[model samples]
Target chain A: MDTDLARERILDAAEDLFYARGIQAVGMDAVRDAAGVTLRRMYQLFPSKGDLVEAYLARRDARWLDSLATHVDTVGPTAQARVLAVFDWLEDWFARPDFHGCAFINSFGELAGTSPQVTAAARHHKDAFHAYLHQLTTAAGATAATGAQIALLAEGAMTTAAISGTPAPARHAKAAALNLLTLDARPVASPA
Target chain B: MDTDLARERILDAAEDLFYARGIQAVGMDAVRDAAGVTLRRMYQLFPSKGDLVEAYLARRDARWLDSLATHVDTVGPTAQARVLAVFDWLEDWFARPDFHGCAFINSFGELAGTSPQVTAAARHHKDAFHAYLHQLTTAAGATAATGAQIALLAEGAMTTAAISGTPAPARHAKAAALNLLTLDARPVASPA
Candidate 1:
């Protein structure tokens, strides 16, 4: 196989294993085994476990955001619905059998303080997410601060859903986001 | 030392090590060295790493909530202000030299998928936190859902602050919580 294909398989395996088992608990040999790559080929591609981990996170970030954006774009009629569509996407992701929270959040929890690469990756992913929210919320007629608040609600939803073993937090956060976004214009009822 | 005291020291050491370093990265030997306890005593106290981890979370939960309650109680004039005090507590916490996000969050990120004990501890901690927010928000005249929203904001703040290496998210979340709590009553001026 080409180096590109080899690299993709390794990252796919690493993302699965790392997300399931935490980074520290998984070793490169396990990645090689899971990816069906030889030890030499895996090392040739990644050089180190850290390198593989970074690639895994970077790939996952792009893919995850793409999925969210695709869903948002599919359902888009207005900016506000697109902004709210993220939680709907989150609910779908949470319901997946293999879903395991935001990979960036999970990776940050496992490696942020010790690994600058991991920290930078997580920071980059989160910043992009916040920027997306800012753009969407601003287009939806909310201030940048409203965008920031909505980002917090979404981030909080990710954490709560991951830990609480339920996707309900996504709906909870979506309702709150609606209040925060629309309260400037109309009367609001409590989220039922 | 008495068994209970030995256990306390063990938990203290474990908490420091686990929080600074990811849980899976720290070993029992390092914990023993940090606590200055005998291997036999460590085993007698914890039996396994999972037991020590559970104890660490259980202890931290009580202490963290207690600290939040103390700050809220000391600075009380209104239920709304008391509810907002959580952000003040978060700001202070974020400023702490050793602060590395909530212990339960970090642990859940590290072990929740595989460890039932850690999962239960993290879920319980998050639920209790949500309950506290519910009690306070209801007292402050918001719906239970409003309290849930504030909890999401606070959880999001913990995440953003921890990853972004700043305390500003706490204030951002506080502003959002204020808006959430008071949206029905007045204009929010966009969280400035």
Candidate 2:
């Protein structure tokens, strides 16, 4: 296989293991085994386990942000719908059998403050989310304070949904987004 | 120290280590050292590391549930206020320097399918949160479906807040809770 293919294979194996188990629990040996590659080839592809872990998180983060941007763009110009669209996406995402909670948060929890790469990746995702929410809320004609409030609500709803193991968090978030819409006299979409 | 104090010390150390570091990363020796107890005492108090972990989680679960119940009771007869109280509590809890995300969720992420004790604790806490939300929503006169919806929003909010590394999740949850109150024709409380 080409080096590119080998790299992709290693990353795929790492992502599966990391997400399924955790970054800490899975070892380089397991990654090599899962990828059907020799230890020498694994080392050639990535200098260290941390580098592989960083690459895994980076790939996941990019995909998440890309998906978020796409979802926002696909939803019509209505801010409320856009906000709701995000949660709708999350509901589907979490329902999968392999569903774990947010990867960035999980990484942060596992690594604690030990890894700068992990922390930076987690922070980047979070900042991107807040910025996206801010833009959407602002587009909806909410004041800075109101937009902040709406964004905060969206953030909280996501956390609750992950921990509480119920769909209520998403539902409440949609309702809250609708409420924000109504506060500014914008037409609200019916909850799907 | 007395048996009760010894137990408390072990739990305290476990909670500190477990929260500061991943469960898998902290060995029994470290826990023993942190607690200022011998290995024999640690094993004697809790027959296994798994038992210690479960006991630690159980303690946190009880404390959190108690706090939730107290907050619900303290809020006036309005479902909206009761719902808001949940996030209010979360905001306060998360503000603490030691505040990491939910321990149950963290443990679940670490153990995932590998450890039965961790999974059970995570599921138990999750179920309890759902049941509590359901009861509160129902008491607030929401239809069964609406209550479930609100509960989902709450769950999502909590997860997102933890992931996003912003208190916004809890704030968003409060707003969503307020919206639910409006829908249910209950009085809304001031934001915390």
Candidate 3:
């Protein structure tokens, strides 16, 4: 296989192993074995275990962000529908057999603060979600503070869904988000 | 020191170390050293690392549940306040210097599906929270399903707050919980 193809295969294997097991639990050797590549070949593609992990997180983050962006584009422009679409996307994710939880979250919990790369990746991914929510809410005509609150609730719901092993958290979060959006009696005062 | 005291010391050390550092990173020898006890003493008090982890989780669980119970009792018997009180307590927790997130949640993420004892303790602790929410909501006059939904959201908010490294998620979750309880028009007909 070409270098790019081999690198992709290695990353795919690493992501699966890291997600299914954990970053600390899965070593370079295991990634090599799973990827059907020799140790030498693995080394050639990725210089260190940390590098492989960074690559894994980057790939996963890209896919997740892209998927969310796609969902937002495909769904209606209304803030409510767009926000709800995020949860709808999550429902599909939670249904997957390998859906252990959020990969970034799982990594953060396992790695703690040891790896700056992993931490940065996780934070970036989360910020991306918040940005999307903020933009969607702004378009839907919410004030800055209210948009932030809605985004926070949506993020909380995602975390709760993963830990509690139930989808109710996400659904309730969506309900709560809708309520927050629609409850304002008067339009948000235009920015000062 | 007495056996009970020594056990507590070991568990306390283990909890601090495990929470700060990942479980796999801390060993029995380290626990013994941190507790100011010998390996023999450590083994006598807790036969295995797993037992020690369980004991640590159990102790933390009891303390958390007790705190929540007290909060609920002090909050004037209103379901909404009781629900919000949980988050209030969490805010206090997240604000602490030693706060690395929920111990049970950190443990659950680390252990994932690995050990039965860990799984059982994690599940039992989570179930206790759910049960408490259910009772509080029922007393506050919410339908059974609404109680469950609120409980799930609260749990989710807590987890999200931990993972995202932001207090806003939990704060937003509390706001959502408040909104759920104070809905002007019964949004969803109270599930009988």
Name the candidate that leads on lDDT. 1
**Per-residue lDDT over B1-192 for candidate 2, one digit per residue giving the tens place of the 0 to 100 score:** 799999999999999899777788899999999999999999898999889988999998998899878877887777657766777887877676767677876777678647777777887887888788778877777766556555655555555555555665667557656655556564333343
User: Model 2 clash tally?
Assistant: 36
lDDT of 2 by residue, A91-129 (tens): 666666676677877777677546778877877877787
DockQ value for model 3:
0.30
Per-residue lDDT tens digits for candidate 1, residues A60-114, read 8899788888999998678889999999998888777877778888888888768
Report how far residue B41 has shifted in candidate 2, in Å: 2.0
For candidate 3, give fnat to 2 decimals.
0.23
The alpha-carbon root-mean-square deviation between model 2 and the true structure, to one decimal in Å, is 4.9
**Which residue runs of candidate 2 sit more than 4 Å off their true CA positions?**
A71-80, A141-176, A186-192, B71-80, B144-146, B149-169, B186-192
Model 1 CA deviation exceeding 4 Å by range: A185-192, B184-192
lDDT of each: 0.87, 0.73, 0.73
For candidate 2, give the DockQ. Answer: 0.34
Q: Residue B95 error for model 3, in Å?
A: 0.8
Chain B alone, candidate 1, TM-score of: 0.94
Against the hidden reference, what TM-scores do the models get?
0.93, 0.84, 0.89
